[model samples]
Target chain A: MVFRELSLPVRLLFYLFLIVAAVSILYPLTWMSYTSLKTNEEVMLSPFGLPTRVSFENIAEAWQTGNFTRLYANSLLIAIVSVVGIITISTTAAYGLARYHFNGNRALFLYFLVGMAVPTQALMVPSFKLMAILDSWAAALHLPVPLLNSPLAVILTYMSWSSLAIIFIRAYFMSIPPELEDAARVDGARELQILRHVMVPLAMPAIATMTIFYFVFFWNDFLWPLIYLHKHTLRTIPLGIMHFEGKYVSLWSLQVAALSLAAWPPIFIYVLFHRRIQRGLTEGALKF
Target chain B: MANTSQAGAAIPRMRPSRFRLPPGEAWRENLYGYLFISPWILGFVMFLAGPLLVSLGLMFTEYAGFKKITYVGLANFEELIKFDIRFIGSLRVSAVFAFWTVSLAIIISLAMALLLNQRFKGHTFFRGLFYLPAAVSGVAMTFVWAAMFEKDYGMFNQILRIFDFDRVAWLTSIEWALPSYIIMRLYGVGHYMVIMLAGLQSIPDDLHEAAKVDGANALALFRHVTLPLLSPTIFFLMIVGMIGSLQVFTEGFMLTQGGPARSTLFYVLYLYIVAFTERRFGYASVLAWLLFLIIMGLTLLQFWLARRWVHYESEEA
Candidate 1:
C-alpha cells in the first residue's frame, strides 16, 4: 500500500508499462476517430496525421449514404422493447423464485441455468425454421400479425437469449433480507403491490445494471439481425455497417466514419457508466 | 413481498397448517412456476431443443436442407475422420487459436488486474478505455480493424515502415492472418481484467500481511497467497474462453473468409459454411455434435485437473 518505498527504477518501469498498455488499448479508437474526419486524399497521403481540414462531410455522407439514421432508429427500438420485456418478465419470475418456496423450484432454477450454456448458434437453424413456420401459421389463420423480418423478430430472439440476466437478478434478489418482505406482508400489501413498491425499489441498482447490459447486447447484436431481418429497412447498426461496406467498395473515409458512428453509442455509455458495469459484471460473475 | 403472506395464508386454508404443502397446492405452485417460465421454456423447446434433436437426427442422413434426407448412417462422421482434408486442418487451426488466445488472454488480464488492484491515478478512466471494446459491436470494430490492417495504406504497415520492414499482408497471407485476428480480438481484454480485479479485491489483505511478516517477497507471496485463491476465477475464465474461442466466427467471417489456403478456416466457420452455404445440414449436425462432445470432454478434463491444483480456502484442503 505504501508506494513511497518503491525504488525509482521500478517505479519508472511500472509507469512505462502503464503507458504502453494504455496506448495499445486506446490508439485504435483514436486512429479510427482521426481517419473518420479526414478526406480520402488526406487519409491516403498521411494515415496518421491530423486532418488538414476538420470536416463533418464524411459524417454527413456516412449518415445519408449508409442509411445510418434508419439503422440507429431500428437499433434503438429493438433494444428498448427487448429490455422492457426482459426486465418485466424476468423480474416477476425472479421474484417468485426468490420469495416463494414452491415445489420444483430448484429443478426449475436449474432448467433456466442450463439455458445459459446453450449457445445461440446451436439454436439458430431451428429458430429460423420456427420463425418461418409462425409466419405461415399466422397467414393461414388470417391473423394480421407482422412477425418475420420485423422488429418483433429481433425482439423475441433477444428475449430468448436474455435468460442469463434473469438468473443474475434472481440471485441478487435471493441475497436480500427476508425481514423487509415480512414487514410488507404484515401491512396486508398484495403480492403485486409489494413487488412494485418494495422489491423493485430495493433492486433498482441491479435493474439499472441489467438495463445497460441488455441495451448494449441488443444494440451490438449482428447474427440475429443478419439472419432474421432480411429487409434493409429493418437492419441494425452492425448489419447496416456491413451493408455499407458491401455497397461502397473504396469509400474508406466514409466507411470509417460510419463504423465510428455505429460503435459510438455503446462506447459512450460504457465510459459514462463504467463503474456500474464493472460492479454489475463482477457481482454476477463472482457470486453466481 | 406481500405475496409471501398470501402464499402463507393460502397454504393453510387450502390444507392443514403444516410446513409442507398439500398435493393440490404443490401442483398449483408447480403450475405457477411453469407459467412464469413459459416463454423461455416454450422458446427453448420449440426453437432450441427441437432443432438440436433434428440436427442430431440429421447426422445420420444426407439431408441438404431442401432434399430428402437420405439415411447415410455414419458416412459423414466417417468422412470427417478419415477422408476430409479440411476437417482435421480446421480442427488443428481452431485448437491452436483457442489455446494461444485463452492462455495469453488470461496472462495479460491477470497482469492488468494486479496492476489495477494497486491504487493509481486515472485508474477508472483507464479501466473504462480498456473495457470499451466489450461494449462496442464486434462487427463494427472488425471493420475498423480491417482498415487498420490494410496492407497498402494501413496504420500498422506505416508503423512497420518506421523500422524499415516491408508491409505485411495481415489479412491476406495465410501465415499472418490468424495471428492478426488473435491480436484484433485481444483488444477486448478489459472485460476479463475487470473480472479478475474483482476476484483480486475479494482476497483478504490480512493474508498478504501475514505472508509479508514471514519475510515472503512479492513473487513468493503472490505464488503462495494470490494464485491459490484466484484459481477458481482463472478456471472459470479458461472454460468460458475456450468455448468462446472454439466458436469464433465473426472475425474469420468478416476479415478472412477462411482464406489464404484455409489457414484461418476456424471450425465453427467451416461448420457454418457446410450447414448454410453448401446446404449440407446433415454434415453440419454431425460437426455440431462433435464440437459439443469435444467441449464437454474438455470441460470435464479441466474439472478433473482442478481437483489437483485449484485450492479453495473455504473448502477442506
Candidate 2:
C-alpha cells in the first residue's frame, strides 16, 4: 500500500477542485437560509444582497400560516409508525429466511426481489381503487373510524414498500456467523429466544441504519401522500409545501422560508447519521 | 423470565426441535412465512397486480374514468403515434432531458466523490452537506428552485443583471424552461455522489500503489485502472438514474406545469394528465406500458454492455 507523494501541482489542483465542489454543493442551501430571513421588499429589491434586516417574522409567519405544525405532526406519526411496522415484519421474515430451511424459502425470496424491480407507477392506479373499495367497505361495516385520507392509509402504503428493507436485513443476517446462534441454541434457547437475545442485538448497527433510511424515505415521500390524502388537515410536509405555494404565489420570501422549514428536519438527521448511512450502504449490505 | 421458562418447559417439547423443519413441519413453517409476509402479498394482489392488469385491459378501451369503458383497440396508440404532435414532441423533450440529466449527474457526482475521497478538513461535514438535497423532498426543493429562477426579482437573474447580462426567462420562456428544470435538478448529484464515494472507497489502495510504482500518472491511472474497476458501480448508478429521470414528474408538475409551450412536458406528466385530468385511463395505460417497455429494453442493453466493460476482479479468479 505504499504510495508516492503527489507533486505540488497535483496537490494544488486537488484542493482547488475540492473548494469549487464544496461551494457549489453548499451555495444553494446557504442562499436559501439567508433569503428566508429577509423582508419581501428586500428579497425583490436585492435578491442576492445581504439582508438589510435579519428577522424571524417570515419563519414565524411560515410556521403559523403554512400549517406546518399539523404537517409535521402527521409526517412524524406516519414515519414512526411505518418504521416500526417495517422493522418488525421485515426482521421476522428476514430471520426466517436466514436461519430456517423451510419449503419455498428461495422462491419467496425471489418473489420479494421481483417486487423491488416493479415500478410504483404501474401500481398507483389500482392502489387508489383498492383504497376506494376499502373506504366503502368500512362505511358498509359501520366502522367507528374513517379510513380514507388518514395517516393509517399512508402507513399501510409505506409497509407495502418494505421489500427493499427486508432484502437488506436478510442479507445482513446471512452475513452473521451461525456459530453465535448455535451457541444460544446449545443453551436450550428456543428459536424466538435466540432471535431476541442473540441475533437482534448483534445486528443492531445495520438495524439502526435501516431505521434512519426508512424514516428519511417515508418523511420525504410526496406522491403517495398526495394521491391518498385529500383532506387539507392530513397533508404531509411535501403536500403542505405545494398548498402553501399555490396560496402564496407572489411571495418568494415566504415560499423560501416555508421550503427551508420543510427540508431542514431530514437534512439535519442525515448530518447526524451520515457516517452510519454510508457504512450501511457500502460495508454493511449489498457488498457481495 | 424464569416463570416463562418454566411454563415453556412444562409444555410438551415440539417435534422437529432443531432449526431445520421436517417434511410434515414444512407446511406449518411455510404457513408462518406466508403469515409474516401476508401484508405485502395482500397489497401486491389487491393493489399492485390488480391495477396492472386493469390498466393493461383499459389500454384497449376508451375509459374517461367516469364513464363506462368502451372498446377502442389500438386507437390511443394510433393517436399518439400519428395524430398527436405534442406527444412526439414531449417524447423528444423527455428523452433529451433524461439524457443530459443522467450524464451530467454522473459526471458531477463522480467528480464530487473523487474530491471527497481525498483527506481534507471537515470532510464529514462536507459529505453530509452534499447529501442534503436527497434527504429533502423534491417538492420542497422545487419550490425553492422556482423562487431562485423567477424571471423578475429572482436571485439568478439578479446575479446575471449584476454581471451586465440579460435577465433570462427561466421558467416562462420556451427556450429556457427545460434548461431551468435541468439546472434545478443538478442539486440531486448529492444522492449519487454518496453511492459513488462508497464505490471509490471499495477500490483497494494497493491497486493505486501498484499503478504509481509503474509510473502511471493520475490521468493514466484513472483511465486504465480506476475507470475500469469503477464501471460496475457506474453502470448501476446509470440504470437507476435513467429509470428515475424517465419518470420525472414532480419538477414538471410543480415548477413548470409542463411548461410555457410544452417545453417541459415530461413523459410521466403527460401520462398523469391523460389518466387523472382528462380521464383518458386507456390512453394513459398505453403510455405507461410504453414506458415500461422502454425501461426494460434499456436495462437489458445496459446489462449486455456491462459484460463488455465492467471489470469484476473475482470473475477472473
Model 2 docking tier (incorrect/acceptable/medium/high): acceptable
What is the TM-score of candidate 1? 0.91
* Model 2 C-alpha lDDT per residue in residues A1-288, reported as the tens digit of each score: 111266778777866766787787677777788889998888888777779788888888999999889999998999999999878777877777765545667777766555555567655555666677687798999985555787887787777776777777777787677767666656778677877899889888878889999998888778789778999999999889999999987777898899889888877887788888777765532242
Candidate 1 backbone clash number: 0
Candidate 2, residues B15-45, lDDT tens digits: the string is 2123443355556556655555666567555
Clashing pairs in 1: none
lDDT of 2 at A158: 77
- lDDT tens per residue, model 1, B1-317: 12222556443121111245555556655555555566656655665667677777878888765536699989998998889888888898899898888889999999998887777667777777677776674788888888889898787898899999999999999889989988877778778888888888889999999999999999998999999999878887888788878978878887787998999999988887887788787788888878867776665655556566555332242
Q: For model 2, what is the alpha-carbon lDDT of residue A179?
A: 65
| CAPRI-style grade of the A/B interface in model 1 | acceptable
Which residues of candidate 1, in runs, are more than 4 Å off?
A: B1-19, B22-28, B67-69, B295-317
**Residue B72 in model 2: lDDT:** 94
